[model samples]
Every structure is written in C-alpha cells, then in structure tokens.
Target: MVDLKVKLGSLELQNPVMTASGTYGYGEEYEDFVDINRLGGIVVKGTTLHPRQGNDYPRMAETPMGMLNAVGLQNVGVDRFISEIYPRIKKYRTNILVNVSGSTVEEYVETAAKINALDHIPGIELNISCPNVKEGGMAFGTSCPSTIAVTAAVREVYNKHMMVKLSPNVTNIAEIALGVESAGADSVSLINTLLGMAIDVEQRRPVLSTITGGLSGAAVKPVALRMVWQVAQAVKIPVVGMGGISNAEDAIAFMLAGASAVQIGTANFIDPKVTEKVIAGIEDYLVRHNMTSVAELKGALQA
Candidate 1:
C-alpha cells in the first residue's frame, strides 16, 4: 500500500486530505456519508470569542463557475464550542482543528488560547482573513504586519500546531505567509476564497447582501495552485492548499505544486463522499506512478 501519511508541524495526518472549515460543519454532520477516521483532519466551522449571528440575508451568490459567500463567521462562541461542540467531535480518530477567527488581535488570541486547552484538538487553522474591525474593515491577512502581529500574539498563548490560513485577496500572499511563518506559525493554508461579487440586473441591485463576498469552487483552482506553489517555495513550514479542489487530480496537482496536503471546500456541497474518493484516487495514482509514498508528490512538478 502506498503510504499517505503527512505532517503539518508536529501533527501527523494519516493522509493529506481534510475538510474545509465552513463546508464540513462539525464531523457529526457528515458522519453518515464519510468515514471520519479515514481522513487526515476535520476543521470545524469558524469560531470566535463570542457567538456571532453572521451577515444579513442573501449573503451568498452563485457565479459562472463558483459561489460567493459573506457568511461573516457565524458560529457558537468558543465557550460553547469547548463545552458543547468539542465533546461531540473530540471522539473522532482523525485530527480535529478549529478554524479560529476574530476582528481584533486580542479576540483571536483569546479564542485560540481556549482551543489550546482541548486535549483532543491538535491544532487550529488561524483564519487571519477575517475583517479587522479596529482597522476600518481591512482584513488582517491583507496586511503583512497585521498578520504577523495577530499570529505571534496567538502563538504566545496557544502552543499546539498553529496553521495560519492566508487570504488570496492580497497583492503578495507569499509575503504574508512568510510573515506568519516568522511569527511562529507551524504551517500555513492558503487561497481563502477570492473576493468577488454578483449583481441582479433585473432588480438593479447586488446579488448578495454584502456587495462583495469570498469566491470558491473550481474557478479558483488555478489561482490557488499558483499561490500555494509560491508560498510553499517562500516558507520552510508545511503548506495546506485549498480553494476549489474537486477531485484527486486537482489534489495531486496542489501537492506537485507544493502543498503537503489539501482541503476540499465547495466540492463537499456537491458530494459528501468526495474526500473518500480523493484518498482512494491518490493511492491509485501512486501505484500507477510506481511511487511508494504520497509525500513524494510534493513539489514534484518538472517546472
């Protein structure tokens, strides 16, 4: 059997496939469709210091090849996650990661600190893409300095595997990834939905409540692949790539581009069992290529 185990900092995933935060909800939601233990990890929905009701109605819109979302990180506060949600999901055999988000650096740090105490949680995907309320609504990950500051602050309080998820809406995502790496991020996940919007010509109004929202699906794959390649080359830590991976071929391309692992986002909405199919397909490709371990696919692109 081809070895599929991969590492993200000190955490060793049985395979390199994981479910994106918002797309997969808690592990229990997909338990009937997926074998949760067979996957590498499960990143729960975005969590914050306090519960958020999220953006108003019509916050999501469909485009040509993708979807736009301004979900605004609606979630139970970290306290509820720790006391209620954690107990339900901690039983999964795979790694359980929380995608932590906040509008302020202090909020991020406090939320992450709480997750750090959970013995079952091995790490957190620090979502620096959240809008920085204190800074007039600019995303923290869009600014290199702000990214480092928040990452470093949380790194101080949380000692587990801290994977900082990067925003694709920046001019220099690689630079931001490097900043987080320097700030003590154990690894980095990239290409969080590109900023996009749609309008209703008939109604003469924006398609979504928020004029613009994050875009994800097959359309973002090319961009996500390029950014993952760039950041993987720019940083020493592991890279977790996600943005539109729908199949094993796409997942393999990210690994060859430089991602040590990949997260399936929009595709989950299409097929709840997509993650299982990808894991199987990866092993099949390894066998066909006469490869022994999936790790060999990392940065294997001839280019």
Candidate 2:
C-alpha cells in the first residue's frame, strides 16, 4: 500500500484530505456520515472573539456550477467553542484545526492565544479571506500590508502551526502569499471564494441577502489551481490548496500544482463521503503510476 500521510507546517496529517471551514461545521456534525478520524484534519467553522448571529435569512444561493454564500461568518465565540464544542471533538483521533476570524488584529491575537491554550486543538487556520462580512472580511486579506500585520500579530501569540487562508479576490495573489510567509505563517491555504453575485431580474432584487457573496464549486477549480501554483512558487512555506476540488483527480491536480495538502469544501455539500473517496482515488492513482509516496507529486508541474 502507498503511504498517503503528509505534513501541513509541523502538524502531520494521515492524508492530504481535510474539510474546509464553514462547510464542515464543528467536525462532530458529520460523524454519522463518515468517520471523522479518517480525515487528515478538521477545520471547524469560523470562530470569532464574540458570538455572531451572522447575516439575515436567504444567505445562500445556488449558481450554475457553483454556489454563493453570504452567511457572514456565523459562529460561536471562542469561549463558547472551548466550553462547549471543543470538549466533544477532543476525543476524535484526527488533528483539530480551528478556523478563526476577526474584525481586527487584536481579536485574532486574543482568539489564537485562547485556542493555543487548549490541549486538544492542534492548530488554527486564520480566515483572513472570508468575503461575506462587512468588517475585516476581505479587507485585511486583499492588501499585502494588512495581511502581514494581522498574521504577524497572531504569530506572536499562537506558537502552534498556523495556516493563513488566502483570498482569490486580489490583484496580485503572489504578493499576499509572500506577505503571509514573511509574517511567520507556518503554511498557507488559498482561493477562499471568488466574489460574485446573482440578480433576480423578475423580482428586481438580489438572490442573496447580502447582494454579493463568495462563489464556490467545481466552476472555480481552474482559477484555484492557477492561484495555488503561483503562490507555491512564490513562497517557501507549505501551501494547502482548495477551491472546486471534488474528486481524487482534483486532489492530485492540487498536489502536483504545489499544494502540500488540500481541503475539500463545497464538494462536501454534495457528498459527505467525498474526502474518503478522494483518499481512495489518490491511492489508486499512486498505485497505477507506480509511485511509492504521495509527497513526490508536490510541485511536480512541468514547463
């Protein structure tokens, strides 16, 4: 059998398949559909310094091949997450990656420090790219300075592995990637969601309550792959790529494009078992290609 284990910063994942934030909930919700331990890691929903009720109703809308979400980072506060959700998930065998968000640099530091004090949580994915909210959502991530400042502030507090999730809604993604790297991020994940909108001409209104939301699904695969490839080349730190990944082939594509690991997002909405299937598919590809280790495929792209 081929070895599928990989590393994201200093954390070791059983495989390259991890569940993205927001889509996977708190990791315990999907326990019935699939064994959570089988996954490399679980990136729980975005957690803030204070509990947020999120935006109003009709926050999600389906597009042609993708979906738009303006959920506004609805999540329990860090205190609640530790007092409630963390205890239950601590028993799981996989690495627990808390997906954290903040409206300001101070919030990110406080949240990261709190999670760092936790015994079971292994790392944190700084969600600097969420596009649905009004404050500090894509604002910090779109610019290089803000990204560096926020990441550096959090880095000083959170000693554990930290992966900075990047936004695709930028002019030069490579500059942002390098900025995070300089700020001491252990690794980076990309292409959070493309900014998009849908209009209901007949109703003379927008599909989502927020008017515009982040677009995610198979339609975004090509763009995501390109960004990941570019960021990987620009940074020495590991890159965890995600976008429209739905199958083993897609996962392999990301690995070859320079992703140290990959996360499955919208695909989970379609099939809860997608991550397991992707792991299996990767194994099959490795066996067929006579590859001994999956790590060899990292950044194997040709000129």
Candidate 3:
C-alpha cells in the first residue's frame, strides 16, 4: 500500500490532500457532501482577533477559468471560533489547522496566543496574503521584510507548527519563503491568490467592489506550480503547495515539483468532493507506478 502520510514540521498529516483556507469554510460546512476525515488536514477560514463584516456587496466574481474574491477576511473572530466552532469540530476525526489573519502585528500575536491555548487545534496557518483588507492583509505577505516580521512575531507566541501562507503578487516568491523559513516557520504554503481584476466593459466599471480581488481556480495552476517549485527548491522547510489544484494529476505534479503536500482551493467550489477524489486518484497513481510511498515523489523533477 502507498503511504500517503506526511509531516508538516511537528504536525502529521494522514495524506497530502487538504482544503485551502477561505475556500473550505469550517470543515463542518462540507461534512455532509464529503468525508472530512479523509483529508490530510483542514485549514479553516481566515480568522481575526475580532469579528469582521468583510467587504461590501459583490465579493465574488467569475473569470475565465477561475474566480475572484475580495471577501475582506470575513470571519467570526478567534474567540467565537474557539468558544463555538472549535468545540463542534473537535468531534471530527481529522487534524485541524486554523487559518489566521490580522491587521496588525499585535493582533496576529494575540490570535496565535489564543489559538495556542486550544487543545483540539494542531497548527496555525498565518494568512499574510489576504488582499481585501486595507492595512496588514496582503501587505505583509508581499514583502520579504514584512513577511519575516509578521511570521517571526507569531512564531514567538505560537509554539506549535506554524505555516506561513505566501502571496503570488511578489516579484521573488523564494525571497519571501526564505525569510519566513529563517524566522523559524515550520512550513510554508503558497501562491495564496494572484492579484487580479475584472472589468465590465459595457458598464465601464470593475465587477468586484474592491476593483481588484484575489484570483483562484484552474487559471492559476501553472503560475502557482512554478512558484511552489521555486520556493521549495530555495527553502529547507516543507512547502504546502496550493493554487488552482483541481485533481490528482495536478496534486501529483505539485508533489514532484517539491511540495511536501498539496492544498485544494478553487476546485472545491466546482465540486465539494474534490479533495476525496484527488486523494483516491493519488492512491491509484501510486499503485500503477509501483511506488510504495508518496514522499518519494517530492522534488522528482528533471531538466
């Protein structure tokens, strides 16, 4: 049998297929459609220290092969998540990774501290790439220094596995990846969402309220794969690759390119059971290829 189990720092994942934050809501939302336990882990929606109403109307828009979203980090805050959501989700038989966001360094630290106290949550994914907010959302993720600062700040407070989510809007993703790794990040997940825009030529205005939103879905697969490959090669820390991943083949390609594991995002919208399908597909591929372990495929690229 193919061993799909992998480790993201101290946290162990049963498989490499997981739902990307923001795209997967709280795991519970998709429990009826798919078996949540089959996933490697769940990265819940981006949570802030305080509840946020998110952006105004028209937060989502459809593009050619992907979707644009400016949800503005709409979440029920960490307090509510821990007090309410966490208790309910603890019953599920799967690792829980909290996706965290903040407008300031202090907020990130406090949120991490609060999550650190939780007994059920295993890890935290710092979403430094949310482009919807005005202050610290994508701002910290786009630059190397800011990424290091934010990651290191959270690292100091949270002792558990810390995965930094990177933005695809930067010129050099490897630089940011290295910065986070140097700052003691356990792992890194990338290509959050490409900064993109859509225009209503007839209406002479942008379709999304923010004018520009994060682009996700099949349209971003190639770009995200390249970034993941580059960052994985540059950093020693494990890379949790994501961006437009739709099927087992896409996940396999990411693994061979150097990702320790893969996260499924936009594809979930088209099919809620996408993660389960990808997991089975990966197992079939491994069996056909006569591979005993999925980890052997990591960084198996050729020139």
- Quote each prediction's TM-score: 0.99, 0.97, 0.97
Candidate 3 TM-score, true structure as reference: 0.97
Instruction: Highest TM-score: give the candidate number.
Output: 1
**What order do candidates take by lDDT, descending?**
1, 2, 3
Report the C-alpha lDDT of model 1 over 44-147, residue by residue, as the tens digit.
99999999999998998877787989998999899999999988888899999999999999999899999999999999999998989999989999999899
Q: Over the full model, what C-alpha lDDT does candidate 2 score relative to the true structure? A: 0.91
User: Candidate 3's error at 48, in angstroms?
Assistant: 0.2
Give the runs in model 3 whose Cα sits over 4 Å from its true position.
Answer: 130-138
lDDT of each: 0.94, 0.91, 0.90
Model 1: residues >4 Å from true position, as ranges? Answer: none
Q: How much does each candidate deviate from the true structure in C-alpha RMSD?
A: 0.7, 1.7, 1.6
**Residue pairs in steric clash, candidate 1?**
none
**Candidate 3 residue lDDT tens string, 130-240:** 432445345888878778888999998899999999988899999999999999899999879888899999999999998998899999999999999999889998999
Clashes of each: 0, 0, 0
Model 2 scores worst on lDDT over the 10 consecutive residues at: 129-138
Which tens-of-lDDT digit does each residue in 1-303 have in candidate 2? 898999876899999999999899988778889999999999999999999999997999998897999998888899999999888889999989999998888888999999999989989999887432445345789988889988999999999999999999999999999999999999999889998999999999998888988999999999999999999999999999999999999999999999989999999999999999999999999999999888988999885
Candidate 3: residue 105 Cα off by (Å): 0.4
